[model samples]
Target: MQALLNVILPVFIVLGFGYLAVWRNWFSQAGVDGVMVFTQKFAIPCLLFNAMANLDLGQSFEWRLLSSFYIGALSGFALGVWGARYLFSRDWQDAIAIGFCCLFSNSLLLGLPITERAYGSGALTANFAIIALHSPFCYGVGITAMEIAKARESGGRASFFKVLKAMFSNAMIVGITLGLIVNLLNVELPEPLGEAIALIARAALPAALFGLGGILVQYRPQGDLRVALYVCVISLTIHPMITFALSFATGISVEATRSAVITAAMAPGVNAYIFANMYGRGQRVAASAVLIATGISIVTAWIWLTVLP
Candidate 1:
């Protein structure tokens, strides 16, 4: 059906194109870097702003649903960290890497677009609520996890508040904030500026996805199949499954709740991996985890969509 294709087809196409581009050596890191720069500097801001511009901001947000999702992701992340510590007996860095991977989902690059395609405008708004929570939680919990993990490895401490502030200032967050301001003011971007933002903002997803593909090339796994497998089971399989079970309990609108539930399950959540690697906490492990987790998302997405209410 058109619905499934709209959601499913483009996801693979992007992946496939990324793979081909890499396979053909079409772009260097510099090229990918250029794309990222453009998106982050311009496109992403536009996309975030434009996305908010259309939302009906007055509708009461479902605090319960968002809270449950956030709490569940945090708990799931903590559970993974605890288990990884016991099983791996690894330093905090690796444990935090695993924890962040388990907690974060690919809501922006993959989840939101698909939700928009499948459900419509309101679903996009619902996804926005979930995404708004994602960066703050990931940055906050992730920094704590990283510092805990890193102290053992590097004898250094990470300032959790500093990390939180940095995430709050990230371009995406600024875009969201500014977009909300514009929406609240009942103002639209003027024609010239709006056109530029639209053009640049359109590139954010592709740039991110392509950057993800290129980043995948560096994954060597460090001979830890178990690490990759464990993270996958938690991130790809368990997280969404848990969301669905909770969804069944909530008796919310099936379509909206289902979008959140299944997306939570299928999202690969590359940011966690990025942060983990950046902080010297199992970079290779996080890289491998991200690559494998994202690869699995396509099949898992089909499965989750088919079975979820």
Candidate 2:
């Protein structure tokens, strides 16, 4: 309870405040435009660059741990596929979106802050590894899911392998590649350059949260309360299960890995929905997942600590 009050609740409180602003008509439906620009133009880039550039590549990356995290996430992905197919009566497109929402978590904007808050900077390396590993699934499998979802609209087969090619070429892949290359090379960015990056990274969190607020305000799940509830479960429940299983089974140092699992499982990375919107794959569903999962994670995280050994 204290953890919820001290750490997670503050984030949601701010977000709720944003919702209040929306309710007050402080901004028209169009009022979010400025904040959106600030988020994309500055915050997100900064956050990504800061995380990548400052990554302590000097610290040993435990391949076993990496494999554990990957497999855990992969398991979530598979479950998402099966759940969407047999349970939802959804066509390929909706299933694709549901799977994407269920599996690909918000490991960036929300992940870093929450992990740092709960477990401290010590857990950062593992968090970094988790977020870094998310790309292949997002761009590769997630995008492919979206493409096939769309392909059915045309009554044509979307070659699964071809979608992999498109996924590989996504901008997120390019951004991470560029960031990693610079980091791995041990390039010394001048102080001024580093300052610029820091300025951008600083904006990522507030902009991301506020943007989330704006988006949720814009897209409420009206007709599909059932679908929204379904999203809340997948986004909040099953995803966390995967993270928890991986953290425990891998013998991860308890505090760090547990924190990672709890928070990462809570929300869909904003980028996931951005990619969904880009591909026109169940954008509404993705948006609702991001919103509701993030909303409920506050209580869920509090409960997780109680069960911790």
Candidate 3:
């Protein structure tokens, strides 16, 4: 219990501090945005690159983990779509929005930090292995599906190739690609260069949590309460359950199975909101789902950590 609290308390404290900062107007929105940009473009990329560059990919990579995690993720996504379409009487765009809310875990900001602390940095190799697959599956499929739906609605055209191209151009994807190449070639980063990367990478932790807090302060749950609650049920609860069951059924490595399940337990990714806002479909509902899921996830994550082997 003490060990678990040690892992969990600091995360909430940092997140709480960020919320207090923004709530009290100590950090303006612009200031928070700047910090977020740094975290997204520099700190996170550096962190991922450093982790991947130095690791033994041969031993670290787990196909079972990816398979099991995605199985759960896609399952949750399909459920969200069906629920929104039939249960909530939503159109396809709204269903896709809800589906994304269910599937996309907040892997970078919340999952990475919590997993690093809760399971230790040793577990990070497994978590990053999941992170490597996150954007590809979540954004690649989610964005393409949403775009296709929008185009169909508007009598326009949409292409999966465009979505793939945009997704590959993402900074995190670029970092992951470079890191994989380096790891595959067994390239040793020089001491100075490695230290430089490490210094920048270290900033991701606090920056991400703080950014999350600030963004939460801005999000108002002004949407369909029923739909938001339904999304939360899928995202915060069902997704993790599916992940655990699938991971166990697959009999993956202990570390990979644990990491995959825990990552699946994370709250809805903020990118869900970004996509909703961009498409202007079910924006408020997406925000509401994120808010509710994030608030509820603290308890759910602790429960998962307590119960998981």
Candidate 1: tens digits of C-alpha lDDT, residues 215-243: 56666467667877788888777777667
- Which consecutive 10 residues in model 1 have the weakest lDDT in total? 59-68
Could you report the Cα RMSD, in angstroms, for every candidate shown?
Answer: 2.8, 3.0, 1.6
Each model's lDDT: 0.71, 0.67, 0.85
Per-residue lDDT for 1-309 in model 3, tens only?
764578777887898888899999999988889888888888888888887777777776667778888888998899999999999999999899888888898888888878888778888888888887788779887888888988998999998788988788778887888888898888888899989989998988898899888888988899699999998888778888888888888888778877888889888988889878867888888899888888888888888888888
> Once model 1 is optimally superposed onto the true structure by TM-score, how far is the C-alpha of residue 148 displaced, in angstroms?
5.3
TM-score for all models, in order of appearance:
0.87, 0.85, 0.95
Candidate 2 lDDT score at position 259:
52
Q: Name the runs in model 3 displaced over 4 angstroms.
A: 1-4, 155-157
- Top TM-score hit: 3
Can you tell me which runs of candidate 1 are displaced by over 4 Å? 1-6, 120-122, 148-161, 185-188
Pairs clashing in candidate 2? 46-201, 47-201, 105-269, 106-268, 106-269
Best of the two (1, 3) by TM-score:
3
Q: Poorest 10 consecutive residues of model 2 by lDDT?
A: 219-228
